[model samples]
Target: MARSRSRSFITTEKPTTYDEDQFALPNLNSNWVYYKGAWLVHIILIICVKILLSSVPGVSSETSWTLTNLSYMLGSFVMFHWVKGVPFDFNSGAYDGLTLWEQIDNGAQFTPAKKYLTALPIGLFLLSTHYTHYDAITFLVNFTFLAVVIIAKLPQLHKVRLFGINRLEVE
Candidate 1:
């Protein structure tokens, strides 16, 4: 006895208004200037941290690990900054934005896979810092400085509008 294959299939029609709405898209004048600016800020911080690390001395192998870990943290920070810059609708600390790749169909996607690209360094640094010998204080200072610089810049870069205010005038 030969059994016949079932031919039951349901195909729901898509809403007609969907295509119309998609075609008549709203214009989004996203300001990417801030994104690039953030990138520059990260780059500068990375360099400065490296410089400060090199200048400080009397580092044990463990302290060296800490320094390396600091580097990993800094690199992750830079990547995060860059990722944040990618254009997406953001709520005022209310809702999370979509992932970079999710917005790729809209002609936007972060160039690199930031998760692993940034994570590997962090993992290696952690391993080295944990097992190897190096000065906790030296690493602390350098890492703290880097963090302070990066964090301080965020408000100035994103929130503060200084277009009309004169820098020369003392407030």
Candidate 2:
């Protein structure tokens, strides 16, 4: 027996509105069950490592300071990429993702005041120090800001306009 192709008497329709709850992002900050414990763990670990390195004799304090500062710089760059909601382009052979200015145009809702509050002091300190010297206070301040971005900003990226829950839902 051959099956006959048939059409339904009723017409099909696309959905007009998605359920609001369907768009809720994972509350990584408050939802501790789904995510690991407080960000203070990482902070404490980093501080412990720094203290241990400083304790070792013959390890130049300057070198230790430089390495710590370099970590902040590298982390800042990586966090900038993730915060802008850009994916890593493996084939490009370069990380030429959207810059911060481009992200703003694309509806990134970062508070300008907050960003400048954290960034300006670090920028001025770097410039004033001529980028050659590393002070513990300045390094600590920069790392603290970077830590906030790491713990908060990356998670918030999951709720942005263009790149939020839609992407997660699709995935």
Candidate 3:
């Protein structure tokens, strides 16, 4: 028997999935995230941001870490979730509607890459919290960003847009 695909009540529209598109050719846009170096890039970017923020006058360690955490979190969310469509035009717009996260691994959940991607934000949040000395305000702010990043990766929220944000126009 075939399993039925379910949608959450909050899900306003179903997302178009391209499982077969992977067999035709590889998606350079999403596949790059799997590279060993790509993972390192995230860490390097985090460290760079931490340093940049730290160098600014009057920016304490706590503030620097919090800024780094927020910067990475927002960038991750926008890159993997907020933005739709592929950067390359090779696929003839086949992936025009899917975000990088959805395009990765052909929308499979809990893959090794996905797990690592999910964990990166959590780890960063922890690092920020520790560096911030567990300040209540910093913790809450970092936690909120982390929460959004984690929620965006959830299979349930795949291709979902709340309040019509980021929904592709169907003209």
Q: Which candidate comes out best when scored by lDDT?
A: 3
- lDDT by residue (144-168, candidate 3, tens digit) is 8899899989989877777666666
lDDT accuracy of residue 87 in candidate 3 = 73
Ranking by lDDT: 3, 2, 1
Task: Compute the lDDT of residue 75 as modeled in candidate 3.
Answer: 91
Q: Candidate 1 lDDT, tens digit per residue, 88-155?
A: 43422111121222222332333333332333444454455456544677556655745543442332
TM-score of 1: 0.30
Best of the two (1, 2) by TM-score: 2
User: Best by TM-score, which number?
Assistant: 3
Give the higher-lDDT candidate: 2 or 3.
Answer: 3
Alpha-carbon TM-score of each model against the true structure: 0.30, 0.33, 0.86
> How close is each model in CA RMSD to the real structure?
17.8, 15.1, 4.9
Among residues 3 or more apart in sequence or in different chains, the pairs in candidate 2 whose N, CA or C atoms overlap within 3 Å are none
Range of the 10 consecutive residues with the lowest summed lDDT in candidate 3: 1-10
